[model samples]
Target: MWDRIEPLMPADPVRGRRWADHRRTLGAIAWKYRTNSPWRDLPEELGSFQTAHKRLIRWAVDGTWEKIFAAVLAAADALDDIDWTVSVDSTVVRAHQHAAGALKRGPKAEASRLTTHSDAPAVG
Candidate 1:
C-alpha cells in the first residue's frame, strides 16, 4: 500500500527542509484514525502528530487524497476485484413521516420547549 501511495505523494517544491518519513507519518495518521484519538495523543515512535495532521490536510486541500482514491479504485477494477453491481433492499429501508412536508416548529417554540424543564430546582 505504501509503495502504491509513495508515487502519488506531491513533490516538495524548492525543498528547504526535508519532509518527515512518509511511512512513519502515514502510520501515525492511521493510528490516530484507527483509535479515534486526538492528534496530540499520537505515539512518539510514529513521528510528530502535527506533521501527520498537516500532511493529511494538505493532501485533502490539494485534491491529492481524491486522486489517490480514484487511482486505487481504478487499480482494483483493473484487477477484476470490484463488484460493480449494487443491491438495495426496499423492505429493510425506512422513510420518516416528516418527509411528506410536515410543518416544523418555529425557533421561538423550539427554544421555549428546550428551556422549559419539569424537574424542580435543587435546594441547598
Candidate 2:
C-alpha cells in the first residue's frame, strides 16, 4: 500500500528542515485513527506524534490525500478490482435527557427567576 501512496506524497520543501519519512509518518497517523486515540498516545516506533499530526494536516490542506485516493482508485479500476457498489445505512441513537434541553428543577424554578420585585421603589 505504501508503494502506491509514496509516489503521491509531496516533495520535501527546499528551504525548511527535511520532513520525516513519509511512510513512518503515515503509519503513525493510521495507528492514531485505528485506535481512536489522541495523537499524544502514538507509539514511539511511529515517530513523534506531533510530526504525524502536522503531516496529516499539511497533506490534507495541500490535497495530497485526495491525489492519493484518486490514483489508488484509478489503479484498482484498471485491474477491474473495484466493485463500485454503494450502500447507505440509516441508524438512530437517542440523546440523553440533558442533551434534549430539559429544564433544570422544572418550570417553577425558572418562573421565580423571571419574576420582578414590585416594592423596590422606582427611580424618579
Candidate 3:
C-alpha cells in the first residue's frame, strides 16, 4: 500500500538501513494524534519522534494526505465498499471550560466575525 508513497518521499541520505518499519512510523503518528502528546514524548520503539512529525508537516505542506484519502475513497466507491444505505446523524460537540486555557498577561485577541449567505441561516 505504501509502495505508491515511497516514490513520493525524498531519497534518504546516509542510508545504512532503515531501523523502523513504515507501520511503526504510522503508529507513532496515530499515538501522537490520539493522545495529543508532544512529538518529543513519543515512545522510542516507535522510531524517532521528530522524523514522524517532520513527515506529517511535509505532507501537510504538500497536501499529500488529502490526495491519498480522496484516492482511497474513489477506489472504495468503484469497488462498492461504501454502504450508501447507512444512517446519518448530526452531532454537535459543546466545548467545556477545560477547553479554555488559563489566563495570561496579554491583550484580548480579536474574534473573527461570522458571515452567512442568503441560503444559510441568519446569524444574529
Candidate 4:
C-alpha cells in the first residue's frame, strides 16, 4: 500500500529542512485515522504526530489525497479488482442528534422572540 501511495506524494522543490520518511509519516497518519485516535497519541516510532497531521491536512486541502485515491482506484479497476456491489446497514449507522433536528439550546428564546407577537398567543 505504501508503495502505491509513496509515488503520489508531491516532492518538495526547494531544499531546507529534510522531510520525514514518507512510509513512517504515512503509517502514523493511517494509524491515527484508522483508530480514530488523537494526533498527539500517535506512536513515536511512526514519527511526530504534528508532522503527520500537517501533511495530511496540506495534502487534503491541495487535492493530493484525492488524486492518490483516484489513481489507486483506477489501477484496481483496470485489474478487475473492484467490487461494484453496494450495501447499507442502518442498524450499524445512525445520524447525529443535531442531524435528527434536536433543538439547540441557546437560540430558542431568540428564535421565539423573532417569531411571536408581543400581544398575541403564539401559534405553532
Candidate 5:
C-alpha cells in the first residue's frame, strides 16, 4: 500500500526545512482516525499530531487524497478484490409522520385555542 501511495505525496522542497516523513505522518493519521480520537491525543512515537492533521487537510485541499484513493481503488479493481454493488433496503429509510410537515398542534389543540373564556361557567 505504501508503495502505491508514496509516489502520490507532494515532494519536499529542495531548499528548505524537510517535511515530516510521509510514512510516519500517514501512520499517525490512520491511528488517529482508527481510534476516533482527537489529533492532540496522537502518540508521540507516531510523530507530531499537528503534522498528521495538517497533511490530511493539505492533501484534501490539493486533491492529493483523492488521487491516493483513486490509485488504491484502481489497484483493488485490478486484483478483482473490489465489490462495487450497492444495496439499500427501503424499510431502513422510514421517517416519522411528524417529519412529513404535519401541523405543530393537532385538531383538538387548535379547537381549544378557538374557545372563548366567556363560555366557561361562573364561580361564586
Candidate 6:
C-alpha cells in the first residue's frame, strides 16, 4: 500500500524530522484515526503526535487525503477488489428540548458552538 502511496505524496520534509517518510507519516495518521486516541497518546513507533497531527491538518487543508483515498479506490477498482453490491446510508436524529441535558433554569450558554462537520468529508 505504501508503495502505491509513495509516488503520490509530496517530497517536502516535515519540520524537525529528517528520517520520517510519507508512508510512516500516513500510517501514523491512519493508526491514530483507527484507534481514536488523543494525539499525545500515539505509540512511539508511529512517531510524534505533533508530526501526525500536522500532517492531518495539512492534508485536510490541501485535500491530500481525498486525493490519496481516490487513488487507492481507483487502484482497487482497477483490480476488481471492491464490493460494488452494497449500499449504506445514515439519517440524523433531531431530539426534543428534554432530550438535551441543558436546563432552562441556568444561564444560557453560547448555543451550538460545536461543529460536528469541521473538515468532515462530504458524502453524496
Clashes of each: 0, 0, 0, 0, 0, 0
Off by over 4 Å in 5: 85-124
Where does candidate 6 stray beyond 4 Å? 13-19, 85-94, 98-124
Q: How well does each candidate superpose onto the true structure, as a TM-score?
A: 0.64, 0.70, 0.49, 0.67, 0.69, 0.63
Residue pairs in clash, model 5: none
Q: Report RMSD for candidate 5.
A: 8.6
lDDT of 2 by residue, 35-82 (tens): 999889999999999999999999999999999999999899899999
Which wins on lDDT, candidate 4 or candidate 5? Answer: 5
Residue 103 shift from truth in candidate 1, angstroms: 13
Ranking by lDDT: 5, 2, 4, 1, 6, 3
**Predicted candidate 4 versus true structure: per-residue lDDT over 1-124, tens digit per residue:** 6678878888864878778887788789889989998999998899888899998898889899898899899889889999888897777667999798665678675685557647887666
3 against 4, candidate with superior lDDT: 4
Model 6 agreement with the true structure over 36-72: per-residue lDDT tens digits: 9888998898888898898889888887878888999
Question: lDDT of candidate 4?
Answer: 0.84
Q: 85 in model 4: Cα distance from truth in Å? A: 4.2
Q: For candidate 3, report its TM-score.
A: 0.49
lDDT of every model, 2 decimals: 0.81, 0.88, 0.70, 0.84, 0.88, 0.78
Candidate 2 clash total?
0
Mind giving the per-residue lDDT tens digits that candidate 3 earns over 10-118? Answer: 4444768653555677688989999998999999888898889877787678887777677667778888899767677889877775576533343442221234446
Candidate 1: pairs in clash = none
Error of 5 at 58 (Å): 0.5
Which 10 consecutive residues of model 3 have the lowest summed lDDT? 106-115
Clashing pairs in 4: none
Give the range where candidate 4 is weakest over 10 consecutive residues by summed lDDT.
108-117
State the displacement of the C-alpha of residue 56, model 2, in Å, after optimal TM-score superposition: 0.5
lDDT of 2: 0.88
- Model 5 is weakest, by summed lDDT over 10 consecutive residues, at 115-124
